[model samples]
Target: MDEGRPIFQQIAERVENDILSGALVEEGQVPSTNEFAMFYRINPATAGKGVNLLVEQGILYKRRGIGMFVATGARERITARRRELFVLEYVAPMLAEAASLGIEPDQLGQLITDQLTAGRLSEKETR
Candidate 1:
């Protein structure tokens, strides 16, 4: 966990990462607040705050007696939300930088393609 962000946000992001990676499926039971607290060595209230954030976002739901479970279509919903965030967080800033550098759209496209291709090639070589 980075010291820069709140622990609760980090906990929420951990669950999001799990859902995106298929480790946590829709309708699956999530770790209880106590479980999270024990695992992370944090307070139960802090863990509960993270879990509640997901509940508010419709990512998780609770049964009266049972624990929280991942909501149906949570992955799809999260993916869509993250895509929008990616555009705002990454793409917009990249485009702005490219414009400031006087890079045309086509030039920026080619640069991105080249970088992607190089990365793929390097990965293959490492393997």
Candidate 2:
């Protein structure tokens, strides 16, 4: 749990991560809010709030007699949203910094490629 962010948000992200990683497939049941509360030592209401965030986002759905389940296309929705966030939070800032340093887009591309190649070589050496 990150002290800097709300616990409920972290809880929601954990479920999203699970879905994105294929641990929670579409239509698969998710743990109850009570179970989440017990696991994280949080209030049931707090856990439900986290779960509800996904419900509101269409990432999950509820059945009257059953617990929550992942919604169809949830993984795709999460991936698209995360990609947008990545560009907003990381790529934009990196681009601005590169411009400030007089690094052209082409130079940045080459630098990125170089780093990736170096990383692959290092990984191979370790293996």
Model 1 TM-score relative to the real fold: 0.93
For candidate 1, lDDT tens digit of each residue in 58-113?
Answer: 99999888999999999998999999999999999999999999999999999999
Each model's lDDT: 0.95, 0.97
Top-scoring candidate (lDDT): 2
Candidate 1 residue pairs in clash (backbone atoms < 3 Å): none
Q: Where is model 2 poorest over a 10-residue stretch in terms of lDDT?
A: 1-10
Q: In candidate 2, what are the lDDT values of residues 6-45, reduced to their tens digit?
A: 8899999999999999999999999999999999998899
Error of model 2, residue 73, in angstroms: 0.8
Give me the runs in candidate 1 sitting further than 4 Å from their true place: none
